[model samples]
Target: ELKVEQNPLFLSMQEGKNYTIYCNYSTTSDRLYWYRQDPGKSLESLFVLLSNGAVKQEGRLMASLDTKARLSTLHITAAVHDLSATYFCAAEPSFNNDMRFGAGTRLTVKP
Candidate 1:
């Protein structure tokens, strides 16, 4: 089984600031994915890290993974009120691809 951990479950940031959310897994996997969700909404895929050092960026959000360490990260740059939402990371566990998800980080960006 795979265990996933995420830090800073809640974040409040001012517009124009920067922050990062981290994800750690207890087991090995080749695939990691990041997602975003707004209140009363469904998950929206933001990134897909398929290998070591894989990274993806869209607008103010960036995501990366280190397969050797079973770690992934989501970086937010130049915060904006519109960016307020919850973020999650999921991993394909132990090569079984069973899939496990992090607890999620809720970010509130203020102007």
Candidate 2:
């Protein structure tokens, strides 16, 4: 089975609003990561967490990982048009080199 899953494949958020996305995995993993992508652009690495209780944030986004629970969270403090993009969470399995990505949360920040 795939290791990673994310909810709300599409998120329509208003400016100055706050929201959170959830990522759940099926098994233990070596690493978890969050990435953002703009239209027609490559992914922009957001966070890489290797252990449980690891949390990191930049700008309006915050990410956390809990290895024991096999879950991750991405919180958006205040949405903006500039923050409109696709967010993905990935996991590297403990026994394999492959990384599995979530379907992705597409955030649309409206004015």
Candidate 3:
């Protein structure tokens, strides 16, 4: 089976609300990354977690990696209409550079 999994394939949030997305991997990996994509748009880089306890944030998003637990988290703070997009978390195995992405969390931020 693929190494990574994410919950809630779809999410809808009202403006000013908050939510957290979870990512779990089946095996050890060297890196974890998060990305966002708007409708019909390319991905926008969110965070890159390279080691255990690695955390990064930009704007309304925050991401963290726990290599020991083979998990990652993407927390969204204060949703907005503009935040409507699909969020994906990917994991790269320690032995290889190829990364695998989650099915994706399709978020809709209502006005």
Top lDDT model: 2
Runs in model 3 with CA error above 4 Å?
Answer: none
For model 2, residues 43-92, the per-residue Cα lDDT tens digits are 99999989899999999999998888889999999888999999999998
lDDT score, candidate 3: 0.89
Candidate 1 local lDDT, 1-111, one digit each (tens): 888999989999999999999999988886898989999999998888888988899999999899888889899999999999999999886458588889999999999
Model 3, position 81, has a per-residue lDDT of 89
TM-score of each: 0.95, 0.95, 0.94
lDDT of 3 by residue, 1-111 (tens): 447899888999999999999999988888898989988999888888998999898989889988888889999899888888899999988788889999999999998
How far in Å is the alpha carbon of 2 misplaced in model 3? 4.5
The segments of candidate 1 whose C-alpha lies over 4 angstroms from its true place after superposition are none
Position 45, candidate 1: lDDT: 88
lDDT, candidates in the order shown: 0.90, 0.92, 0.89
Residue 26 Cα positional deviation in candidate 2, in Å, after optimal superposition: 0.9
Q: Candidate 3: deviation at residue 56, Å?
A: 0.8
Model 2, global lDDT = 0.92
Judging by TM-score, tell me the better candidate of 2 and 3: 2
Residue 98's lDDT within candidate 2 is 87
Can you rank all candidates by TM-score, best first? Answer: 1, 2, 3
Ranking by lDDT: 2, 1, 3
